[model samples]
Target: MSAVPGTVQTVGLFAGQHVLAELEGVDPALLDDEPFLRRTLAEVLDLAGATVCDVISKQFEPQGVTVLALLSESHASVHTYPERGALFVDVFTCGTRAKPERAVELLTEALRPTSAQVQTINRGEAEAPADGHREGAS
Candidate 1:
């Protein structure tokens, strides 16, 4: 069946996760530690309405950390450094409208940051396929 005229196409629905945060007073050792990063990633995923399937983390000497989480519907991640008082995070959910920004909010609150900054961006919407291109391509 052909799509009704003027109706919005359902080729690929839009959704994504991305946020940058600045935090203060955290222990660099803890933040840059793999175990800590994994625990934090799990909590963040739960709070973001996503289920974490697996987590991989890497630590940089002195003070830097990165974590990647593979989730059921999507993924959530973070990079942290207590020495620099900074954290970068990303949460991506595909085909669902689950809001991952709340995770950032929770983290900001948990860290009890004296000063912080947050930036969020949606990553996949603009690339949604046009109706004509979607109709028979699938």
Candidate 2:
């Protein structure tokens, strides 16, 4: 059904948080920096108290980067588009232990995107994530 605004609603089966962001106008260099992205994602996840199992990243031939982390709670990832000076981030976690939304905020703060579109959702709930910021974020 529908989640009542201003009230916390219980999810059907999985009580999880999923944060998806679209960050635009980020530094192209930062977008292409696989090391920085990897380290930042790892550090933020850690700060969020997530148990990171492993992190894998790939630097594209011409540009761009993709960093994905396997978390004991779930998964977090970033896909960059250097040519467009943008990136897409996803932080999904099971249960209430990990602060997935905080992770996204950290990523956004670090990337310093000119425009950000971020969405947070309660998994198995019917309500769509409310728009926060421009479409560039999530």
Candidate 3:
């Protein structure tokens, strides 16, 4: 049997997932606040259903704040550019325990951007051979 043209067959011990979101016309004031961003990250992680390990946030000299959340399944990060009124978010999880899209949605809602673009990619997908043969086949 053959798979459909648009379908994918995945076989792997781990599922590497990633979500990237680009937000435009966000509130610049919110982007510059370190405490707010930190808190927001925690909320986002919770929304994604991931186990939180540690969080580290830093504010730049002139402006902008970068927040990174270290999750037990993987990691989530956000970087803000206040001057351009834009922010970029990255969320990656190793297994099914986390939902990266939910995390992105939470961040977008908290930022309230005028326009947002989101992308989801399945990384490290392993597929079986097309010949229908296994390693132990005689």
Candidate 4:
């Protein structure tokens, strides 16, 4: 039998932040439409210089509620729940700080909200954390 591969730990440096933005009271249809949601999501990730790793979505019947999650290594994701008109967005990027800000702007434009809130958490070399804590959050 071949030997099992061991975990590799690499340390990279950069300056950026982990941003989490949430919007409340959004129309479910906005998320129910797959094409529109996917397009917008892809655009946001592209702006952050991130690649789309995977996506998981769930839609409810009758109520027309939907939840979408876009996972990425660039440290960002867009989560949406249409039924409740709510959206939860998280962006974590290293080596690039402006990406997250642009992501927030792009999302806000794509997803128009009655009242939207944005919160930015500074991350990067200043906040270099150890291993075993969290991935894509260095």
Most lDDT-accurate candidate: 2
Model 2: per-residue lDDT, tens digit, 1-138? 448767876643356889999999999999999899999999999998788999999999999899999998899999999999999999999877789998988888999999999998888533344654534455
- Per-residue alpha-carbon lDDT of candidate 3 for residues 1-138, written as tens digits (9 for 90 to 100): 328887877532366789999999998999899999999988888878988899999999799999999998889999999999999999998867688899899888888999999999998644435896656666
Give the per-residue Cα lDDT of candidate 1 at 125: 52
* Candidate 3 weakest ten by summed lDDT: 6-15
lDDT of 1 by residue, 1-138 (tens): 338976766644565656656666665666766886788768866876777789888888766888888977677777886677667666667655455677777766666667777777666654536554653456
Full ranking by TM-score: 3, 2, 1, 4
Segments in model 1 whose C-alpha atoms lie over 4 Å from true places: 1-12, 126-138
| Alpha-carbon deviation at 58 in model 1, angstroms | 1.1
lDDT of each: 0.70, 0.88, 0.87, 0.66
Better of 2 and 3 by lDDT: 2
TM-score, one value per model: 0.67, 0.79, 0.81, 0.64
lDDT value, residue 94 of candidate 3: 80
- Which prediction has the highest TM-score against the true structure? 3
What is the Cα-based lDDT of residue 36 in candidate 1? 64
Q: Between which residue pairs do clashes occur in model 3?
A: none
TM-score of 2: 0.79
